[model samples]
Target: MADVVIIGGGITGLLSAHYLAAEGAVVTLVERGECFREASWAGGGILAPMHPWRYADSINELVFESESLYPALCEQLQEKTGIDCELQVSGMLQLALAPEDEILARQWCERRSRVCEVLDQAQLQNLNILSTQFSHALLMPETQQIRNPRLGKALLAALQTNPAVTLHTQTEVNVIETEPLRVVTDHGVVSAGKVLVCAGAWTSRLIAEYSSLQIKPVKGEMLLLKAEPGLLPYMLMCHGRYMIPRADGHILVGSTQQDSGFDKTLNVETAQLLQQHAQDVVPALEGAPVVRHWSGLRPATNDELPFVGSLPDRPDIYVCGGHFRNGLAMGPASALRIARQIVAS
Candidate 1:
């Protein structure tokens, strides 16, 4: 039996294993499907929440905590794994179509002491962004992002190099028994001194006997358009939709949040609509051929605040799921908290 058994191989699970192993805990992670192919892979990888003020303070706390820890963590992952996750410090450009959120953005930054510079329409002209008189803009220069796919690969590589950690792929966990901390899977039963459920949208179902937690999947669709590097310098956002430009000439435009259960089916109509939205915001992408269009299911909670920390009455069992769309941004901090709990116990 391992010191810790983690159920879920997404960002949260991988990072948790990385942290726990670093703390000298013998850890094993079980994934029902390919790790990182879920919400973590489908995310934009932005460091900060999209319009953070709209979220609860608990959500903001996790996001902010992770923001301070990502740079060092990412640097360590790259050095150890030999994979460039493309952690870009490129600033985020937020264009507001209405005055309400514009004012709220100001308040949000000021209250939190976050660095945000409000750019007037005249200043917006410098970005060459097509906008109307009602549009407002801000530049978050301190914001950071990563190519999530590369990050996932780097994480797996890092874990592979660690002898203290074990990773099991394509292992579906059907039931979890807390009496002796055992997990039943198609392969076999694996018992551990402690069990941590980080299964995201599947968390509720996976740990149904443990908690009455309600976690549902919110489907989001995205498009990857191939453009020349430097075509769009910053991560551009307007009207709640944004385009992320990668150094490798991949521009990401996403996404729509709808409660679509666990369905990950790609829709042509949604792709066309997102493509049009992207082009409408920046005419430069008017005819850019879409390199890829995909969708993923986000594990969401009732209030959008992720469930972190241990389960009640089950000190040896832990949970850190329901992160929704902010999994990539929140992974490191969430891992830190969970590791601290395990190490302390």
Candidate 2:
């Protein structure tokens, strides 16, 4: 039996396996599908929380720490695997905020010592891509983003090359036995000294009887549009929608929150609506051809905080899922914390 069995192969699971193996623990990671093909690949990879003041401090704690770790983590991943994750400080421009919201944003940034600038209508007009709909905006100059698909590829390569880690792709865990600490899967059974479930959207269903995490699949649909490089200089957000521009001029316009259960079918109308939203924010993208339309299930909780501890009466089994849309932002620190928790015990 391996020292640790990780169920799920998303960012959290892969990072946990990396940290555990680094701590001298043999890890067995099982994924129902290909590794890093789920939300980890579909996400825009914004490294900061969307609206920091809205979430609990616990969420920010993990997000900021993960943000700090990402530079070194991406550097090491590139050096070891020869894959560039494309981590960059794209920054963010939040427009169309209410007057009270602007005050709260400034107060929150002041408390956190975060660099923020309030741009008036005249200043906002200087942004070439922006529409005249928004008169004022808040600029977060320190926001960073990564090419998540590349990051996923890098992590998978790193884990595959690690001698202490074993990976099982296309393998689904059906039953988890606590007494013997074994997981019965599609292929066979895996026994481990400890089990860390980072299964994301599937976490609740997999451990429903043992855990009451209330994790549900919140469907998010996105559209990718082709634009000129540097057409949009910043990540733009307004009314809960965002446009994240890649270095290669692919702008990601997303997303709609539907309470759809495990449904990943693409909706043509929704994709069209997202395109309209993108054009509304940046007039230059008026006739931009949409390159791709995709959907990913975000693991959501009622309180917007992830479950990152052992289950009740099940010290040998731990959970680190239900991160909603912030999975990419908070994944690394959460993985490191859980790995340390398991190792210390």
- Please provide, for model 1 over 71-108, each residue's C-alpha lDDT reduced to its tens digit, 9 standing for 90 to 100: 78888988897788888888888876467777887798
Consecutive 10-residue window with the lowest summed lDDT within model 1: 127-136
lDDT score for residue 230 of model 2? 93
lDDT of each: 0.86, 0.91
Off by over 4 Å in 2: none
User: What lDDT would candidate 2 get against the real structure?
Assistant: 0.91
Query: Between which residue pairs do clashes occur in model 1?
Result: none
How do the predictions measure up, each by TM-score? 0.96, 0.98
